[model samples]
Target chain A: MEKLFYFSDLFGVAVFSITGALMAGRKSMDLFGVLVIAVITALGGGTLRDAILDNHPVAWIRDDTYILVATLAAVGTVLWVRLTRPINETGLLVADAFGLAVFTVIGTEIALQHDTPVSAAVIMGVMTGVAGGVMRDVLCNEIPMIFQKEIYATACIAGSLVFIGLLELGVAAWIATCLSMATVLLARLAAIRWRLSLPRFHLLDRI
Target chain B: MEKLFYFSDLFGVAVFSITGALMAGRKSMDLFGVLVIAVITALGGGTLRDAILDNHPVAWIRDDTYILVATLAAVGTVLWVRLTRPINETGLLVADAFGLAVFTVIGTEIALQHDTPVSAAVIMGVMTGVAGGVMRDVLCNEIPMIFQKEIYATACIAGSLVFIGLLELGVAAWIATCLSMATVLLARLAAIRWRLSLPRFHLLDRI
Candidate 1:
């Protein structure tokens, strides 16, 4: 079970790192900038989860492998994107969706381990899935997609509920995790395909 | 001593909030964005410190007044800057310097209260002084000023050391806090004037 979880984490890291490197490439940043964004995107979400839980020796600092994998993935992506100008945006979105799904489940699992309530776990899951992308967007000087596109966080929340429901139904941990990831991926992809958006409050108009 | 520290924290929040609003104005962000950035810049560092320490009911969350003041300051600054198109960049810099000094001391003091080691406290102090700006820059989609500029973090480090040394010498808390803040302000202003930079590692080349 633990090994399965670890593998999922590694997969998520690679996907997020590639996405981050692609973002940097879009900006035509130097190699250093690409590496920085990639590493941050891969590790930022988990780091926040650990810190909030007061888990000592943050995830990346404890396991150097995560950093190593992210760096390699980032460098490779940068080179690939450079060699092949105009990488497919659709492909990147699919990868990002996969990363978001995996990370949301992992984050919820970690929060549950810490004995956080279901509500807290759901919030943490959304935070974990979105934070890395938010950090990447901020570094790239773009408005975070999370704030503008409510579907991003909304998908994570939906997945968290599915995970909790599966657990209540006595489903095995692995099965529950897989189902949660699938839910998030499906929801996110659907939203993107249909351009679904939450109702904007438009406080400005009210004022 | 606690009273003085609270006062310093209040002042720091106001100063940083103003600076954040000013930066938002420069970017031509809407008033809502300006307010968000201001509150984030003012409270972000302390919120991070508290979260890392696992202090429940985050500082700003517990004390609504802090959020109110930061919001008011942000709104006022945005309106002021809008009315006065030719903003005074120099004045904002000076206020930011003062904010850095005060925030550094407040952060170090909080760490000390938690009985953290001197080295840890120093690191926390620097994090508290700079994390908000890093966050602001990230949200603005720019490389964090901390990564680009040397003097910013350097000044915090120097001030933290002075704070620790004063404690070792049995200096009064209020006096030590004042001296440390002064040191930070002076070092930061000088660095900005002289354009100091750390030697870039350029790890990519080695790799």
Candidate 2:
């Protein structure tokens, strides 16, 4: 179980790195900028989660493996894009959905282990799933898509709540993890397919 | 000295909150958005720095005073702007410089206390001084002003180095702090006045 968890975390890092690299490419950023953005997009969420929880020796700094995976993934993305046709948009979206699911579970589990309040744990889970993408969008000089009406963060929130609820009801840990991850992945993919989104905030219009 | 440091930190929070609220105002964000941005701009830098240094119970979480100051400052700015003429642009710039100076020194000092390597300490200092603004700019859908032809981060780097160097040379703690803060403030203000900037990266253009 531990091994699976670790590898899935690395998998999340790689997928997010690809998304980040593609965004940097769109901006015509140089190789250095591409790598930096990719790494940040991959690790920024977990870093913020640990920092908020005061988890010592943040993941990448402690293991170095996560950083290596992110760097190699980023470089590989750049080479593949340069040498071949652009990656399929739909494929990238699916990979990103999986990444988001994995990260949200891991973040929630870690927060629970640290005995954080339930509300804080859920927020940490959502932050873990989306903060990296937020940083990536910000660096690319765009409003974060999550804040823009995408059902993205909503999926994470639902997954986190389900995970916590299942655990509280005495479900097996692995079963809860798997079910919750599926919840996020399916929700995200369905949203993408159907163009679903939360209603846009229009506080100013009302005022 | 501790009391002085504490007050200056709160002052920095207030100034940064004002800048954040002002930026949100420019975007015509509603009150809730303005308050959210202001709090983030005020606290985000320190949060990142402490997280990087593995400093536990992140400053604001350990004490709610910081959040209170930030909230009040944000609301006050909104009220002031609504009731009066627009804030003086030059004055806001100067206040931001002071906030940068204080945050840099505080970040460096905290890192040193943790026995972090000097290089990491310096990086933390710069992160503390500017990460919030980076986040603020990103939220507002703009490339960070610091990244785009501004000497903002350079000033933080200089102040952090000066602070560390003075301490290494056995300067009194208070003197080191004061001189370093002044270095950042003066450098930033001068850069603003003279439109100083680092040469833009043209890596792709050259290739």
lDDT by residue for model 1 (A111-201), tens: 7777766666775687688788878887787877565663777788899999988998999988999999999999999988998866432
Q: Which candidate is the best by lDDT?
A: 2
After superposing candidate 2, which stretches have Cα over 4 Å from the reference? A203-207, B1-55, B59-134, B142-207
Query: What is the C-alpha lDDT profile of model 2 across B84-186, one tens digit per residue?
Result: 6556879888988999999999999999999999999999899999999888988988878889966989999999999999999999999999999999999
lDDT of each: 0.81, 0.87
What's the CA RMSD for each of the models?
Answer: 8.2, 6.9
TM-score of every candidate relative to the true structure: 0.59, 0.61
Q: Given the true complex, what DockQ would model 1 score? A: 0.11
Residue B121 Cα positional deviation in candidate 2, in Å, after optimal superposition: 15
